[model samples]
Target: MRIAMWSGPRNLSTAMMYSFGARADFTAMDEPFYAAYLKATGLDHPMRDAVLAAQEQDPALVPLGFVQDGTRHLYMKHMAQHMIDGFPLDWAEDCVNIHLIRHPARVIASYAEKREAPRLADIGFDRQLMLFERLGGLVTDSADIRADPEGMLRRLCAAIDLPFDPAMLHWPAGPRAEDGVWAPHWYGAIHRSTGFAGPEGELPELKGAEAEVLEAAMPYYERLFAERLKNS
Candidate 1:
């Protein structure tokens, strides 16, 4: 199976990727389109040069097709915002796409620490909703997963008809072969962990632009959150 996990920045996307990657039958691909995003937008993101160097600069050359020789599965981790204006998304039709969301306030708070000034588009809530509307995939919340990793994951697996692999509950600390080159910049917190973190505390207070972004993102987030898999 080809699993496309769609999420924005600062969400538990990398951790989820690690969770699936821990499974013996899956080969995880981290942000396969990141370099294409950076190249097309020329956004001057951190590690821009390195990311371009490490990944396929030509989006066309990047292989989105699956060649399943046996029972192996491919879990492709994707950032919603990375689907630029001209990017093609027809590839998603063949995969079991899943949307992962976090509260906008938490996403904003965590993102600001990495990028001093962030806008609504930078965090990808808008893009996430767009994809959710079009692709209609299973939606899961990061907060929900953190609160009950095992239960929620089992529920997620059952919903997708995938076996609930116990290996998804934990992973070895540090980076893996599938990590994007930008890992050094954005994966520190996850790299140091063995599994999902505990439940998050209350949302942090925000002001100025951060607060504005949180406001803009809430409607989309709430819509997806409402569609998230029920606790089981």
Candidate 2:
């Protein structure tokens, strides 16, 4: 089974990827569209040149298949914003899509630390919601996963009719071969841990442009949050 896990940056996406990567039956893929996104927008993201050279810049040629002999499931970690309007999403039609969301305040706070003065588009809440509307898939909240990793994962697996794998609960700390070239800039928090961080505390404070972004993104996040899997 192929699981296309869609999420924005700084939302524990890497950790979740690691959790699934720990499974012997699954092969985790870093952002498959990063280079293509960068090439399409020509936005000067960190490690722009390196990213351009590391992965396929042509969205059409990007591989979406498992590479390992025993790999039974391919878990793709996708950034919602990377999918430009004209980019192809037909590849997702055959996969079990999952939307992973986080609070806007938390997203902006975490994202601003890496890219200053983030805009509404940068956080990708609107884009995430758009994709959800189009793809119509299961939703999971990062906060819920952090509160109870094992329980939430079991719920996730059951929701998809997949057996719960305790192996997803923990993984070797530090980077993996599947990490994207941009790992250095955005993966520090995840790299230092072996598993999901504990439950989040109070939302971070923001001001100026960042605060405005939070306000704009809150509605989108709330809409998606309402659909998130309950803590049953």
Candidate 3:
């Protein structure tokens, strides 16, 4: 089974990827479309050149190839905004899609610490909602996962018709071969983590433009957050 796990940046996405990677039956894939996103938009992200050189450049073909790569179970970590430029969604029907959402306020604040400037699209809430409606798959929140990793994951597994694997709770530290080339720039904390850390602290303070972006993103976030599976 191939699972297309969609999420925004700074949303425990990598940690969740680590959870899946720990399972003996699954293989986790970091942002398979990062290179395609960069190439398509020419965004100057960290390691832009190296990422572009190392990953597939065609946005259109990347997702197709990812779903076709045979594995007992494949967990694909994806950023919703990468579906830019009218990227097709028909292929997503080929896999079991899941949405990982976080409050816009928390997402913006955590994201601002890494990159000062952020747009609504960069936070990914809007795009994520779009995909959720189109794909109609399981929806989960980062806060819910942090609050109860085992419980939330079990719910997620059951929602998708997979057995809940205890191994999803932890993994060896440091990077794995599946990490995107951008791991060095974004994965510092998770690289040291063995399991879901703890409940996230209060949303960080936001000022000026950051606050505006959060305000604009809240509706989209709420639409999906309301649909998140209830944690037992």
Q: Each model's TM-score? A: 0.96, 0.96, 0.96
Q: Which segments of candidate 1 are over 4 A away from where they belong?
A: 64-70
What's the C-alpha lDDT at position 13 in model 1?
A: 97
Worst 10 residues of 3 by lDDT: 63-72
Pairs of colliding residues, candidate 2? none
Pairs with backbone N, CA or C atoms under 3 Å apart (clashes), candidate 3:
none
How far residue 38's Cα lies from its native spot in candidate 2, in Å, is: 0.3
lDDT of 3: 0.86
Compared with the true structure, model 3 gives a TM-score of 0.96
- Candidate 2 structure quality by residue, lDDT tens digits, 1-232: 8898999888889999999999988888999899999999998999999999999898887854434446478899999989879898887887789999999888888887898778887778899999999989899999999999999999999999899899999988888988999999989878889888899899888988888888899898999999999778
Candidate 2 — which residues are off by over 4 angstroms?
63-71
Cα error of candidate 1 at position 207, Å: 0.1
The CA lDDT of each predicted structure is 0.90, 0.88, 0.86
Q: Native-vs-model 1 lDDT?
A: 0.90
lDDT of 1 by residue, 1-232 (tens): 9899999999999999999999999988899888888988889899999999988877776764445537889898999999877687887887898999999899889988997757888989999999999888899999999999999999999999999999999999998988988899999999999999999998899999889888998999999999999786
Candidate 3 residues lying further than 4 Å off, grouped into runs, are 67-71
Task: Using lDDT, give the best candidate's number.
Answer: 1
